[model samples]
Target: MKLLLTAISGLLMGLTTAPFSASYLAWIALIPLWLFTISHKTTSLTPGVKNKLKIRNIIVNEKTLIAFIWGFAYHGFSLFWITGIHPMTWMGVPWLFSLLIAIFCWLFITIWGAILVTLWSVIFRLFIGSKEIGNSPLPPLTKGGEEQGMGIKKKTWLNNNLFQSISRVVFGVAVWCLLELLWNQGDLWWTSLSYTQSPNNLTILQLTKLSGYSTVTAAIVAINGIFAESIFVLGVNKKQFSLLILTGTLGIILLHLGGFYLYKQPLINDLSKEINVGIIQGNIPNTIKLYASGWRKAIEGYTNGYEKLSNQKVDLIITPETALPFDVEYIIKNSSFYSAILKQKVPVILGAFGSEKRSYTNSLFMMTETGNILSRFDKVKLVPLGEYIPFEDILGKIINRLSPLDSRLIAGTSDQIFETPFGQAITGICYESAFSEHFRRQANAGGQFILTASNNAHYSEIMPAQHHAQDVIRAIETDRWMARATNTGYSAIVNPKGDTLWISEMNTYQLHQGTIYPRNSQTLYVKWGDWLTIILTILSGILWIIDN
Candidate 1:
């Protein structure tokens, strides 16, 4: 029954994410599971029954199975759309076999996320379920058949219950954020609570300007922990519960109010250049994007698209990742393609695959009006299994049993900044926008703008919108205006504050021309990446240590 409730809570949490976007539910979604973690009420041992009463507290440091089950439901609901990348899509395999492989990949992601959640649960359980914590000033909790109110004569101990509850909440937020940072080390760091709260809630989103998303995530999780503790003590604390209720209730209100104040502060200055940019949403379908027969039509589409955009006389024109589907050198050697870029005498930034002696890189570069390659920024962060699969020697055999090609691509060096006609711009290819630090590094290095090229053709409808929202978070964190060029529509221009200045419709080919304002002042997050979040996380750990 407990496991069932935990799974339900997980689904409720997933619903607050994309495709549903009922983000208001995130505040209350985790309360059920959190309460389950701390529930250890002792039933009355009246004369009616003695040994039949079963306690409900979770064991110390081994909260794996329930945590895994809960996380499985949560991540499975949120990431089910990833099945679109099954071997059948690009491999042309059997339908039934492809469906099974997709399901297997989806299940692998669910299990991987479940393990991280389980680690958090185990560490939190270890702290709150220890015997050394009894000497603390907090009230003596019931333990080993000890009465709750028997040894709580001291006033210092009376407040232990309050401190313990808050400490439990702190422990949860700290450990959860710890794992969040860990996964961000480049393996399945997709759905942090901070990323989930984008464009929908600007007040919470403002927190990103001062401190990166990790701080906002910690604040939200801590609030969930408080709510869980309050709900668990609902009927039992009727006598002296007013103070506890006030503290918990006021804590939530104050947190949001503080966030709102920060959001409304005069944070960004409008001192930078106003860029007149045009982006092409090529709307290329993945079915034949790489096919030999479709090469003529693909080249014609981009050439004609550039002609239409050149008429607008925009300062910079952008194209999605791999807009040039063929080999870049071969395509550039053709005078017909170079004529389209050279005719307008304007700079164009487009995505293409480049090769350097047997090694290929997913790269973005500046194409000058004279048909010269100005500067190139190869993709620093590569997607796993999608762009380049890991352990290809072992997993490649199983993957290529159905698919055709399974090879590794080369990774670019750390220092990359593309100097374009419109100032120095930091370029992020595909999922690289999801990592906030990628932008921060370039922003600190004097890159004034962000240009991200993504191929959203591979995923479902929900994916483009989700990807757009993540980019909005990046603009807020770095205080830099950003432009997104996607292959399959939903190209957009976003301001420093994450407002969508101009957005193209999905699944439709169009050129978006708009005026976007950049920022000269660096945000606190851009100046010092994740420093505030790291400090608070360490403070939470110290609180956990003091209580234990």
Candidate 2:
């Protein structure tokens, strides 16, 4: 029954994130897990207690098991879309083997993501001590107040002790934020609690301008903790429940109010400098892109898109990642693509393979109106298993069969910024948008706008939508206008306020032209990076230690 409750809570939490996007569910999603953890006390050894080690082992094992169950459920539901990688016959793998690989990837990522939540539960238990905070002993009755039945005190645990409840919530939120930060450094990070409010809850989402998405994530966790604590004390103490409810309510109001204020503030003092940009979504299929037989369709789709957008005389035209699959020299020598670009007399920011010293890189190139290369930014983060195989020396023989490429692509340095005709452009290839710090650094380096090129032809609708949401958060965090161009759908334009000004349909060849301003101002998140999150984690850890 306890495991069932934990699983339900995990599912609720997962539903609050992308695809489902039930943001309100996040407020109470953790209640079931919190209730179970708060009621299950770890047995302590008294002076004459027998088999203390045995009892302790039993308690520890149970906690770990329950935590694992909850974590697995949460990540499994959230990342179920990973199974879209199946049917790898397009990549020359057998149907049975492709199904096996897809299932393996789904399980592997789910289990790997679950590890952080499991650690969060274990560490939270350690700080909570033998006696649960919800089950802490009541103090003596107030003066002139009568004792309740069975020697129970008339006064509640929170009559004059609100600090205890507040401290616990703060500590829990801090721990969660820290764990998310730790997990985000790894390869499998996709969903964060803050993203639950994105593109819908604009007020609270504005808080990312202060300290990146961690601030909003901290707010979400803190509110959930308060409600969970309140639920625990509801039957035991009505007054405490009221107080907690009020406190949680006020916290929500103040957070939204603060974010609203930030949202209303002007991002740029002068909006006079703007660039007309055209985004192209070439609905190319994965099979066509991989095989030599269908390369013409891929080229023509982008070529037509460029010609159409250039006819409109936009300041710049952008294409999806690897729109031209071949390297720079190959495209220049063997194709009329560059000549057409020069004839158009318009600058284009296109994606193609780049080579330096015979080493290949997935890169974005900014071509001048004169058909000269302006600047290029190679992808810093490569997709694992798809682009590069990790631990190749050990798993190379087996996993290499699943990989599309014969050799791994080299990673580029993060400092490479595209010097465009408009301004310094911050760019990401495909997967780098998930990392907030990467964009933050670019914004700090005087990047006025962001251009993210992606190839989402390999996945379903869910992955592309989730990818688009990540870019929205990145725009708000860095206070920059962002334009995303993808291979097969969800190409969008987002303002600094996290608003999706324009978005395209899936599996469609479309062209969208919008005006985006290039601003030099930086947000606090871009300036300080994740320092605030780190400090909050440290302070919260210290508070938990002192409280225990």
Candidate 3:
């Protein structure tokens, strides 16, 4: 029964983002998990000072396993879109064989992601989730409340519970933040829960301005913690119901106030220079995009999109990842599109393959209006397996031979920034936009605006929206206007305030023109990065230890 509740909570939490995008569901997503723990059997409260909590440490192993179950269900559902890769079978392998490989890949990632949830749950249960906080009267632990509790006014646990509850919530958020930061350094950063809030609850997404995603995540965990604590006391004191409502309202208000205040700061008229960009969505079919025979059609798709956008007087034209099908240089030197783009006298930003020292790099290039190379940004964050296989030196020999996957591209450094005529333009090829730290480095080094190019043709109907949702967080973190160009939809322009100024549709060819202003000032997150969030989490952990 507990397992089912946890799984359901995980599923509901996923619905708050991506294809469904039911943001309100996040508010009550974790209630089931909390209810299970709070309503379970436990030890009686002891009134004496210095008395131990008598917490059987109940549900020790069960909670951790339940957490795994919840995480498995959550990630499995959230990432099932990856099975879209199974179409590789059409590349040459047997259909059943490709489907099995895709299934293996999906399960592998789901299990690995579940570990982050497991770690968080275990630490919460082991450290902050102590039954004392689950059911402790604060008087004995409350400073100077020791005398009053002896007179039987001992229900003051609410006050005491507040401290523990807040600490646990902070701790819970820290665990998530820590895992996300770790993933940012790896290949899985795209799965962070911070992206789950979209369209609606961004009203409170303001905490992101002060402390990056940590504030938003902590606030979310805090809500669940408060709900659980309130449930524990609902029968003990009907008054907790009112207090919980008040506390929840105030917390939500503080978040909104902070977010709205900072969100407005970027709106003031300033001296920042602006550059107009024409974002093109070609909506190319995924079937033949990467093969040799279909390359021309893909290139022509962009050529047609350029013709539509060129006359708008846009300063530059941007295309989705690898929209050129191969490198643009080949087409420019050998094709008519070069003269067509030159006729417009505007630079072009598009994804193409670049070769370096006999190795290929998934790269984004800026071509000058006169058809000269402006700047090149080799994709620093490469997708594992999709671009290059990990442990290629050792396992590549074995896996490459057996699989139809291509494993040759190299990774660029985090310091790679493209110098545009206006200012530094940070380019996040595909999903690299999901990593806040990688994007911030370029912004800190004078990246005025962000350009994220993605190709979502490998997934089903839902992926493009989910991918775009992730970009919104990057804009909020750095206070930089973001330009998202994608293949197969949702190419958009997002302001530093986290507003989607405009977005295109799925499988539709469209052209969007927006102006981006370069930002000179930096948000607290862009300046110090995740260091402050990490420090606060450590401090919160220490406080939990001291309070316990």
lDDT of 1 at 510: 82
Q: Estimate each model's TM-score.
A: 0.89, 0.93, 0.88
- lDDT comparing candidate 3 with the true structure: 0.73
User: Model 1, 526-545: lDDT tens per residue?
Assistant: 88887765776788778867
Give lDDT: candidate 3, residue 294: 56
Residue 444 of model 2, lDDT score = 94
* lDDT scores in order: 0.73, 0.80, 0.73
lDDT of 3 by residue, 265-289 (tens): 6374254566788998877776776
Question: Given candidate 1, what's the lDDT at residue 336?
Answer: 60
Stretches of candidate 3 off by over 4 Å are 35-60, 129-131, 134-149, 152-162, 237-242, 264-266, 269-272, 393-407
Highest-scoring model, TM-score: 2
Q: What is the per-residue lDDT of model 2 for residues 233-254, given as tens digits with 9 covering 90 to 100?
A: 7776677888889888999899
What alpha-carbon RMSD in Å does predicted model 1 have with respect to the real structure? 5.6
| Candidate 1 clashes between residue pairs 3 or more apart in a chain or in different chains | 138-160, 139-160
For model 2, where is the 10-residue window of minimal lDDT? 145-154
Clashing pairs in 2: none
Highest lDDT: give the candidate number.
2
Global CA lDDT of candidate 2, please? 0.80
